[model samples]
Target: MAIQKRVGIWIRVSTDMQVKDDSPEHHEQRARYYAQSHDWQVMEVYRLDAVSGKSVMQHPEAQRMLADIRSGHITGLVFSKLARLARSTKELLEFAEIFRQEGADLVSLSENIDTSSPAGRLFFTIISAMAEWEREEIAARVAASVPIRAKLGKSLGGQAPFGYQWSGKEFVVNTTEAPVRALMYQLFLQLQRKKSTAQELNRRGYRTRNGTQFTATTVSRLLRDSTAKGERRANYTQTTGNNKQWVLKPQSEWVIIPCESIISPELWEQCNGILDNQEAKRRPRGPKPVYLLSGFVKCSCGTTMYVYQSSKNYACKRCKTRISVADIDEIYQVYLKEYLSGINREDYLRQSDQQLQEKKQLLEVTVKERTKLAKRITELVDLRLDGSLTKERYTEQYTPLEERMQQLDVIIPELEAEIDVRNIQLISSDVVLTDAKTLYDEWGSMSLDQKRAIVEVITSKVEITKQDITITLAYATPPSSKSREKVSPRHGFMLAISITFAG
Candidate 1:
């Protein structure tokens, strides 16, 4: 007797409503049926019920499934579809790679993919590429919309400044916070020191919106804000690579919208001028050089390495592992060029464009056919009413026409939707490919700040040891318009490249 192949069933229902509307048990049974057909034993069932598809890898059930695959408890995993497995393209790719490494097969019923076969493996690659392209398109759309929304004086999805609150789409003064905020500027003007201003506010029992005592930093920030003078700045700042720090965007991109004034413009300017004078007086003789990959580079021992004041190398104090700043930059340029070139984007985009055009043409033909069928059915009804044709003949002619029209009704919409998706993918892919090419070709001409921005956007980590340096790249995907989902932690898959270099 032949031994049965052991397999696990994977089910993930993203929402409670979905679980209620569409039976998770149905999905399970379908997988079981697929498994039984192939003489595979149902060894385990992993369920992530009412869970999000964003970052399922950290989920307990997902971890258990991975453990089973790694431990050889199951040589196959059967799921209903790719989206049911994970919405994150990065996570999907990671899962495929892991399964491949473990010599395990993946069976997705809806997609008719079984990784034990060659065609199924090809489907996996195509699906992953399409998902990634869709994600990039969404991100590009969101980025493009930000400045337009800002210029239109629309709320950009954040809390109002300290002194103000959002009343619908309008920026209005917060009744309670406004007084304290106004006092901040007044106190700074009188005391001529941010720390003294904060101390005075704290002594008077004033607190921030978060119910915390005011500090020098808070006082300085509020006093410097132009919102109190009615010119509120929007789209002026953006988060860095790790999404932890906010850095100023270019002045040309900044939008200043008028809002209700909390204080007189003259008074606000007076306060800021004094603060500016103090800053100038305290300014250092020379500015510090900005390192491109500072705070991102880690020593082999796991401590963040940095280039100390005018140093030519990023050194780890704990591990004593060092890499020269110039060498790291050189390696990154080479790595980026090679990485971008390795992507089969040209061939993929060409095929996608062809498919898009075909879909559009099919939709046009479908609509015209549906229209002609409707006309034929109307003419048949007229002929029966006028006694020019028998009722039976009219019915015979109309029934087939109506049925064909119904079929076209279903197909036309699906074709239009597919066309829309493909168009977005093509546009997004073009932008990404153009940017990648520009980044590599213009590396030498780019300013330090420009280079740093690009590095932060793409790189997740840089680890250095005595023998080799590893760079981990993460291409971020923007959230969809529907969910407005925040990018989850380590949201994308990490692409690590090991480079041997002398330190």
Candidate 2:
């Protein structure tokens, strides 16, 4: 009677091996042939291609082979060579122990090493050392390459930031994303005016490059970044120590290139000043009354307005304009009514129709532009195929155009959706008008801050001149109070009488 030997064959080839003639198929064939000669039944062939042998356990085929061995599906293992099994000494030892525990044998065909023989055991140890050396050399090579690539202004490794993309070797500025970056700068400025921290900014819908909600640390980092100030930075590293941690390195030590400035340096300085002031104010101090409009109110002198309360009235410190809080509240309500009255819904409908027409025209223009770009790409592809363009030149030119086409594809859909929404809003003007009326009816019951938000949405600016106050409504023409020949009532209040008494 002849004993049948069930054997699992393992084959591996690293990324570098794929470039050579010696492929995974060649190794598999060799292992199968050797197994047959030894009268071993080939149970399964586990081929792992383009995967490093250093981490053999992570390879899908290797894992399956291990499972088969453990389940007694195979009593022997065969490979082209020991290195084909794993490139790490620790991994080789672990596999050997597994085979030993399972009462199975491992055979390397080319090395003539078998776990069943004494001489083969010595050879396995030598092969394991070689594998460990190979892994260490590869690691050292990678460690050396990263800094050189970074110095060349290439991305080493990490997720790309907004307004920039990684094109295999270099970081290229995406023009479409530039506007979003500019918006962040604008938002930061608005936050500075409100004397709010990054936590507050995040809570108000600000997000990071990855569209994740922002944290206080992320905000602080953004504020301190010279990149927002139109400077490029490099070579920054995060460090960890005994519990306490903070961002290190002086500003001078950072590699900075002045790209197109997103935010002016002066504005950056002003934001820093505001942040410092807010931090100082947060410290232990006497309890102060919290005013919702504290940061938003501005004096006529262009200085930040403060709310000063006296026994008699609230006074504007710079303008010396003293008015009772109740009188101020009444005047605010009257101003709101006047602003709401000035919004002629019919005129807005006419303008919306005009805008809809303009959008249609714009869409036609965009379609034409897209057609031109597609034709250009077709021409470039033909030129490259016909030998008119070298591979390098074709790639350099084609990549940017391809990226632009992708961006256009994304933008065109967004524009079309926006136009659709605008058209719907314009057509349903009556519905919007009804909603606005309802909001106005309940305006008096709203909190002061809520009232201010409502008023700001409808009115852009309200200026009180010596004779009459001028109100500029958003998306509408400004109205002069002097033009009113009579003390006309607006929003259920006489605006002329309210302004006169407000003084």
Candidate 3:
């Protein structure tokens, strides 16, 4: 009997959203399909979900896979693409060397690279370098556009400051949020404490845009923001290092635009003056620890479970129904894999692509309209300059044209922003469908923060009980009309998986 070669599948999706949309089964099936074509047997799967490819050499999953390769547990490894394996050129080269020395084969489905052939080895090096270059080029282009967009008062992605909202590309005071934002300044002046202001706001049932309770940090930040005082600053901050810590850019680089004031500039100044004095004497607080499923976990008794006072378990205050952090995490990982594998993202992608095309068409029409209005205004100005028409007549014709031009200015930018957003969403959707197939294999290699981020995006709530657990997912559509509850026995516990999809 000819011995069938054993191969392991590698799946690594870079982003949390991608992991949410992708299914491990999809990737595994594709890899298995390839393996079957080559007369190979699939024995293992390695996943690095939501883990960065920048330097994956130190990751636990990567180490495990390497150990397996060296031990001959698997003579071959398969993955979606070259970049999915590793983005770092040096690391990719090192991986090639290790696989080569061990006489193991590496197969990249996307690039059609198989290390069993000499041509595949050459192609691997070339593709890795090209991939690294493309990433750098894209990043540089995005970085270059930020300052230009900021200076033009364009939407550079992200919501408007607390009190304001984008009204047709115009930064205007949000009616609902403005009052609360204005009160922050007034309350700060009266209380002289950010914490007290936050508490008062929460007590009054005022919540942030995301409907979260106000915190002292939120209060302090909103108070410091000059947007409420009519000056909106952009390109004033930059992120540093891998953790993306924000630091203020040089004052000279800041682009500040005047907008409608939520509060009087005088009030803003008074509040900030007190804040500035207090800040000098304030002690820095240590960073708070982030749990994997902090806010999403709930007990069957309808009470939220929290990890309190040196405990590794999340316990409800009402019923004291407790589950260890590790247990909930394991359940979440298993459920996510199963739920995602059954999900079909093709419909969603098609819908999103159609919407993106519609937005682009709208943007095109808007630009043309703006151009026509602009040309009409120039002609009106020319009539006034050449004295072909009386000043009164010119003003009559010019006023409405100029007004329409101003309206178009706002409309055009708003349309462009919408298109930009749509394009990004489509790109994300594409990434999700492409990368998620092997995410389960990569989950163990993810950092605590990465896992938490993924949980935050995909999971709505996780209900835990002695007998069962129900998990709700966000932005997912079930494959069947009446999807039955997936109940399975787990070490004397019955996990009743009730999947609910939310918009």
Best-to-worst ranking by lDDT: 3, 1, 2
Q: What lDDT does each candidate get?
A: 0.76, 0.61, 0.76
Candidate 1, residues 395-451, lDDT tens digits: the string is 888888888877776665455444544554455455455675678688789898888
Q: Model 2, which residues run further than 4 Å from truth?
A: 1-297, 304-307, 376-434, 444-453, 459-503
Model 3 residue 191 distance off true place after TM-score fit, in angstroms: 48
lDDT tens per residue, model 3, 1-503: 33789999999988898788775545666676667655788888999999989989889999999999999999989887889999997788778767866878898766656554333554545645665576578867987998899889899889898878998888788899999999888888999988999999999999999999999999988998999988999988876553458899899989898888888899999999998899799889987766889988989887889998778888988887887787777767766776667657787778877987998798788778878888888888898899998999998998888888777665554554445444444554454444554555578897887666566545678888876777776542444422344334333554566656643
Q: How much does each candidate deviate from the true structure in C-alpha RMSD?
A: 18.1, 33.3, 26.9
Instruction: List TM-scores for all candidates, in order.
Output: 0.37, 0.30, 0.37
lDDT of 2 at 45: 82
lDDT of 1 at 95: 89
Please list the residue runs of candidate 3 whose C-alpha ends up more than 4 Å from where it truly belongs after superposition. Answer: 1-296, 299-304, 307-313, 323-331, 441-503
Tens-digit per-residue lDDT, 1-503, candidate 2: 22698998887778865726565655665566556545679999887777887787866787898899999999888776778888887788778766766778887754556553333444445645665566568857875675566566766577655556667765556566555555555666685643255455466675667678755556555666666566657655433332226465565544555455566788778767766887788868777654433343333454444456543444456676433345444555665566457667766667877887898788778778878889999999999999999999999999998998876765554455445434444533433344555788887687866766555444444443222334444332322232342232332333343122110
